[model samples]
Target: MDEERNGTGTHLSDAQLFALAAPAAGEPEALPAHLSLCRDCARALREWKAAVGAVGEADAGELARRSPEEWRAREDETLEAIRKAGSHRHSIPAWRWALAAAASLVVAVLVLTARRTAPPVAAVAAHATPAVAASSDMSAADAADDRLLRDASYLAGGGDVDSGSGLESRL
Candidate 1:
């Protein structure tokens, strides 16, 4: 039925037919051009209109006959059911808490174990000092080379070499 209505598939949608059949304000809706061209859509629209009419015709005398006290009791019962549903609590099971605690304990033990097995920070820093000293010594050598180049340039330009301290003495 759905395939016949929409999948094969050039007919009007069920919603469009329903809207034409049951206009909300009880006014007749304008028919689409497709409805005049398509027999299936016309039949579907008639079916929808009949269904809507049947629903509208259903007797409401039972509800109309209900006393005010009966309606109040029904309302009270509905409210009590809603209150009971809202008040019910959902609790975490005990095994879930136990599992969570176990996982936390495992993580804590792993962290403590790793800390105990690793080298201390003071010892690591002590081992790193010799490498740092070596780098500083290399920089000092580079500074000495730069000073020699500057002095050689000054001498080549006929500047007084005797004005500054002797190169050997500075070295």
Candidate 2:
């Protein structure tokens, strides 16, 4: 960056001056290149940086010391503000949309992969029901459950399991 404005000591164009002096002031990029190397521009940049810092410090000083919960709330509020800012803002880079899209695709793939690779459910029920169905005239759905409980109770009580209950015999 040439420091001198053409070495003519003439004032620079307004865009050139702004780009050098107040870069954070949203100056567009088509400014004069010489202004970048100017000592005056360097000084102006430092001044603006200092001014912005002081203002930030003053704003921070206005707040009181907060409790832990208040600190958490403030943290949440700051994060929420940042979230709202990232979501709806137009002044920043346009590439953010591409980044967000990429992240969403990654998340979608991860969810799909997890679903695809997840463990299969046990097949204990399928084999048992059909085999029991062919062997017994009893509706295996109801009778098998009754048989299981009766067998478990008989085993637990150290007694012989009866072949047929009075209800089944009557049926």
Candidate 3:
């Protein structure tokens, strides 16, 4: 079937021939004309139809031979195999749990270190305001933006906003 066609007219591929075998409603306009004119295509269509019919007969024969109990037992075995495979697949490894714990510990340590290093936000704001107000070049908006940035950093480090002595302790 794969060999180069030695004849004159173009022939239908295997897929087109199969589609013509079990056509949807009124078959394609050109198919009937092609099948009538092309002997090779007609033969291929017949072969595909025969193969389909043979498969249907085999399925029917198999259903008639197999008892309901035998079918149920096969289904049960397949389900048990799936369940066993799923159980092992769903469980996390010990090393993965250990890795997660280690990551959590590292995060906790970093949080504690930042909290210890940062001075209280009140002292910082007090010293910052005087310096910002004295700067002749600094606009009120720029001073406000600077204060917001410093406050954000202080909050991120978990420092107490109302505690600590003054700028001297921070320095």
What lDDT does the true structure give each of the candidates? 0.78, 0.63, 0.73
Candidate 1 wrongly placed segments (more than 4 Å):
3-9, 59-171
Model 2 quality (TM-score)? 0.24
Candidate 3 residues lying further than 4 Å off, grouped into runs, are: 25-30, 64-171
Q: Candidate 3: give the clashing pairs.
A: none
Native RMSD of candidate 2 (Å): 19.0
**Residues 25-101, model 2: lDDT tens digits:** 57544545544666666555556557666776677863644568888998999999999997767645567778888
For 1-171, candidate 1 gives per-residue lDDT tens digits of 463654334787778888899897889889988787777888999999998877665656577568999999999999999878766532346667899999999999999999999999889889778656755776777767756866877778887767783664665
Whichever of 2 and 3 has more lDDT, that candidate is 3
TM-score of each: 0.31, 0.24, 0.31
Task: Give lDDT tens digits, candidate 3, residues 32-134.
Answer: 6767777777788889889777777788987757889999999999999999998767665766789999999999999999989998799899988887676
Better of 2 and 3 by TM-score: 3
Model 2 scores a C-alpha lDDT of 0.63
